[model samples]
Target: MPKHKEYTILLLSRVTLKAHEFITKVVQSNSAFGPCPEYICKCGNIQSDICETATVAISSVYHQVFKTKTKFSGLEVLGFDKTIITDELLSDLPFRPYNFQLGILRIWIVKIGCSNEITTNLAGPGFKSAFIYQYNKSRALFFQEIDKNHCRVTIYYECNAYIDFIEQNPDLVWSKIGILQKYNRNQLFELTNQYTTNLIQAAQIPYCTLNEWNNKEIITNIYNYHLKCCIIANINWYQFFCNKFEQPNTIIELRSALQLIYPIEHEIGERKFRAWKAMLKNVGCSDITPYEKDQSNVLNNLIRACMHLWTQRISY
Candidate 1:
């Protein structure tokens, strides 16, 4: 059995006098709230945008994967592209499974991204490891106004931990496989606590001076703003796929579309080349063949395929 911990932080008069207004302002400003690639959601482009972005920035998954440590022990939780797991990109795992791996691919759905209840799920199709035991875990956050000058925030995290293995297999040793129950449990607590506290402290800052909010009222899509920041941070690969899209699938045609430069141009080494192929494959591109080179059908498919990732992410 694994442990599930819940943590809470209640900031007293430390918060702004205008609880809802201050939070709204913080949500709109990049300096106050940041977005991580772990969880991205956009729907209707409404008031829920800041909530989604704040939720993502303060999530345990974001802290554990991006802020605290990229890799656990020696295993790389983030794949070659360093993106979080979405329902779309599950098939292209960079490495084969180990006996036990924790937090391999997780999704956090917030506000508009979910229905019924806001939740996060750790289980997905990418779990190809030799299954002996497993744990499905989730952490959720709640916000409240304590008073005119205060706020209350709580984080509830639990794990539906379980295992699956053949009892008759004598060679299956738990000790040798490196289980992450205790390690993950402890790390989740630390990261969740730190992230919550940081958000509180950041919100308490005097940021209203950035710009006066007149009677007209200002509106900004914080979730999309942070998402754009993340995309810009990874713009190279983001643009790479964007550019390669719709072009002929042939290696030469794709190369011309990319207009590769310097080391990448000279060094289409095995790793980089394989990565390109994997990226295309992840985007629903069919198997490329020499004869398939100028087919309009192939071109159309490629165009649609390139938009695969974007369409999944764009505001609905």
Candidate 2:
């Protein structure tokens, strides 16, 4: 049997002290802490365990994919997209199998408008309009800002770390997602919840577990559903990786980066790329193959995609 290591994902919302205060005042009251989450009922470990410090100033997932090298190995990025809070827009940007990074940090709940209104942290279909009604007058101004320009609020969210978040932190705030069921709990959190619970069901609990619904079938879901996303998302993520913020997916990027590590002095013509590609495959990139030296469409597409997305990263 192949050796499989236990993996944990941590999702965090980064916010300045100012944004933090605003969110606590506005959305904090939105959720009432439920029962102590079972994942961590006896999980002695704390949030500090696996959750890392949030990096400052990130804009697009498109950007992060190309902006940097990862500090850690065996890690991969999921996918990227900005959030939409309004009712109609929310439907297009549903929360099922995905989530919104609420709280402050320039990104707050969906706003009513810039005239000074608050927004609810509601999920799914009603997420947008419902969020608007939840706002108070003091916050009405910001809502207008969101509505008028469609300015992006938060940076981005990833799939893997999201699950780690539940492992490290209580899924209390996350659990409220069930309420969105009326609107089709089709949001991404449902899978996340299941991922967390699956671990508990096995009784092979970790020292610390997230209170979020366990993803008992994380392996199945990830292999069947999430892997397709990662195959493209991660590869695209790597081609766009930034040398500053972080490297691209170490897991998959290694297949590309490792190319340089190998000796590549085969005939430098049509077979040159083929030779190099063969070397890479030997290392583990079974997906790679040789291409015409003049204008390799595959490699060209990869670079083009990476450049397009990396254009928006926050330069240090």
Candidate 3:
């Protein structure tokens, strides 16, 4: 590996051997001046950013990075969404046993909203609902062409989403920090997903399935914990279905639809379905007994059971 020089470049990924060669021959020579130029390259005696040779060199390195399909590029394309983020993008990432991939997966799990709590007051208009307040953050890619065959690239990444949210919801103080983190994480994931989805479509794959995140085994205790979180966070499982399917007008209709999609046996005198009904009630699925601790327990139990059942049935 070539040693770091006195350039302002921030290396976000492992430098390849070719990159090392380009940097040594081109970057080192140009930036030898006391002050680092905005961009530099070794060939064509070009010292300014306007050099035609530099453009070609930068393009070459840019293509090489994408051709290797670095994790930075993959994440830039696929997104951090639980379903969209995949290992395919991690193929060229320069780290061993890439924990960054796992970090993205964990964020996806949190974005599931299983542990996200929202009071009536906390239900103020979401960022999506306020277009004027909405924005995205991304890394800016810069290419410094050194010569006809050489150039160096750099990235400027900034996370403005969290700060923006805090600015917009100042009254909430630090209470909105978690909300901002959740939203920003999902946004990054979604952006990556969009980028990858386009690539997959271009490649003409029948369909690109997400990574094996959903297939991760959830132990009994973990499942139980998620259940508690769901209740505490006021997660409305019914809302998940309602968003996908038609919104049911009543609890009976909602229950009927759930049963149709996810069949549950009503054992003789077991009142197995009763608990589910009670919990749904708390989540506004039913008009009766909304927010009862006993009903919550029953609901948690039902959700835990459903976790296993759904894992077996769902593919995506």
Question: Which candidate tops lDDT?
Answer: 3
**lDDT-superior candidate, 2 or 3:** 3
What TM-score, computed on C-alpha atoms, does each candidate reach?
A: 0.20, 0.17, 0.16
Candidate 3 lDDT score at position 100: 17
Cα error of candidate 2 at position 26, Å: 34
Residues 251-296, candidate 1: write the lDDT tens digits: 3344444345323434344344444443344333444343432442
**Model 1 local distance difference test score:** 0.28
Ranking the candidates on lDDT from highest down gives 3, 1, 2
Question: What is the per-residue lDDT of model 3 for residues 240-290, given as tens digits with 9 covering 90 to 100?
Answer: 334422322222433443445442572212243444443333232223334
lDDT of 2 at 144: 13
lDDT of 3 at 197: 31
Point out where model 3 deviates above 4 Å: 4-58, 61-220, 223-316
